[model samples]
Target: MQKPYLEISHVNKTFQRGSMLTDVLRDISLTVQKGEYISLIGHSGCGKSTLLNIVAGLTPVTSGAVTLENSHVERPGPDRAVVFQNHSLLPWLTVYENVKLAVDKVWARESASVRKDRIMRALEMVQIAHAMDKRPGEISGGMKQRVGIARALSMEPKILLLDEPFGALDALTRAHLQDQVMQIHHALKNTVIMITHDVDEAVLLSDRVVMLTNGPAATIGEILKVDLPFPRRRLELVTQPSYIKAREAVLKFLYERNKFVEAA
Candidate 1:
């Protein structure tokens, strides 16, 4: 069997909050093929975001391991790029500078022209080139988020991690950004793992949807393969049985089976 490009092996994470130890994730293992899109969906406390953070090397696992392309992931590096739920832009910087900062760091050895090209391409990819001169405060929420994505992409990481990126947006804005993300993934084929609570968003974007059981110690409960064909249209999918079936499977797992667990 071909080895997966990204591997999470028997991972567990625990935190010492005050006097007590809290188990956040337990024995979580997953394999992601290159260029595939995977979505993690569960109730609020399921540790889905925690798992994504571990993969991004933003957080360390307490036990077990995570690897990408056979290299062990120990800390945050250019190989993995993350876009958090909040835009997290440096308020003092313009969109161009925000993305340029990443490109400069990753391609430090390269010439200035090459770095400029990388920044421009990333901004264009997210359709934010027009707002390149605008600071974070000057743009709308959706546009700021797009700049965040562009900054992440400017690094040309092997995998992209999105942590509920559109969660704060209105329904219409969320839907539009979801479509933008799908198109970007379709074009770039970057391996992705996203944490989301939206069932429709998961089904519409992922090649596979990974469902997690509730927390204190969350683990993978079910994995649903989205068998629908690509170049997927939102209008057409609403009426497609395969799409509906996939969407319902995720909803069932979230609502009927694995209910939310209150935090400790």
Candidate 2:
């Protein structure tokens, strides 16, 4: 078997709040294979985003380690690109420029024409080629998010990290963007890790869903396999019995886990 592309080993994180040390993640370990799509799901404050930041090397782990291709994660690099929940695009830059910024930064040594071609290709991959010249302020929320995704993909990272990329959109818009994101992933076959609270979205998008325990020290509670065939469609997936069952399992886990955390 091929080696896992990313590995999180006995990871822990703690924060200093005034005089007290609060643990946010505890003994969390996972391995992600190449070209796999995994979703991390939990309630708010469950440290899902924290864990993604850790994997992305945007934040450090207090203990243990995160390794990509056998190299320990110490700092953020072009090898791992992130798409944040907030659609962190520069307001002054047009859609094409926003993506070009990332490509240029990562591929600075490449010829200017090569970087331009890469940027345009990434925008086209996300189906945002038509909006290439539009500024972020002029675009819809979904379009802005697509620009964010395009920017990330332009970097051609080994692993793509998404921190609740669709969390802020309306339900219909979120669903539509999910399809677009899934299609992009399918075509690229890049390893992806997404943090989300939406169980249905997780089931529809991931090869596996890793449900985290509630925080002040969150850990992996369960890793549920999504056996549904790929090239999934939202409406078709919703109507399928296995998809429904998998979603219910994740929801039940969250509901029960959160209740236990509350009572403690």
Candidate 3:
């Protein structure tokens, strides 16, 4: 059998504040194939982002481990790039500059021309090259998110980690960006691990939707395979029985099985 491309081996995470200990994740194990698109879906506090963070090496695990391409993931490296919901751009820099900052960090030793190409290519990949001269504050929210994605793509990371990257956008813009991302995935065929609360988005984008049970001990509750062939279109999927099946599976897990209630 082939070795897994990305492996999360029985991982666990905990938080310590004063004398209190909270377990956020327990015995969470997953394996992702290279170039596959995956979405982590669960209700709030279910540790979806926490698990993504562990794979990104942004947070340390309490036990078990993560490995990429058979290599231990001990820290954040160029091979793993992250794009968060906030867009996290430097307000002081142009869109081009924001992406350039990341290219410079990962390819500092490369020739100036090579680094410049990477920045341009990445910005072009997200169709935001025209706004390369604009500052984050000067661009619309959707454009800012585009720049954030471009910055992540600049590193040519083995896996792109997205933490609710479109959660802040309006519905129209969200749908538009989702289309572009689908194009990007088809073009790049790069591995993506995204955290999203939107079931439609997951069913539309993912090869598999991994659902987690409710926290503070969130573990994989179910994995739904999206059998619909891709180059997927949103409107077309709406009436697809396969798409409907996948969407209902996710909804059932999130609403009926793992329904969330507020803490008093």
Q: Rate the local accuracy (lDDT) of all candidates.
A: 0.91, 0.91, 0.92
Please give, for residues 1-264, the per-residue lDDT of candidate 3 as tens digits.
877899999999999999999999999999999999999988887798889888899999999999999999989899999999888999999999999999999999999999999999999888999989999989999999999999999999999999999999999999999999999999989999999989999889999999999889889999998998879989888999988989988988887887645311
What lDDT would candidate 2 get against the real structure? Answer: 0.91
lDDT of 2 by residue, 223-258 (tens): 999999889988787789999899989988988757
Q: Give the root-mean-square deviation of each candidate in angstroms.
A: 2.0, 2.3, 1.9
TM-score winner between 2 and 3, please give it: 3
Which 10-residue span in candidate 2 carries the lowest summed lDDT?
255-264
Candidate ranking under TM-score, highest first, comes to 3, 1, 2
lDDT of candidate 1 over 1-264, digit per residue (tens): 989999999999998888999999999999999999999988886698889989988889999999999999999999999999998999999999999989989999999999999999999988999999999999999999999999998988899999989988888878888888899998889999998888888899999999999888989999999998877889999999999899888877876786534311
- Compare the candidates by lDDT and give the number of the best one: 3
Off by over 4 Å in 3: 260-264
Candidates in order, TM-scores: namely 0.96, 0.96, 0.97
Ranking by lDDT: 3, 2, 1
Residue 14 of model 2 has an lDDT of: 96
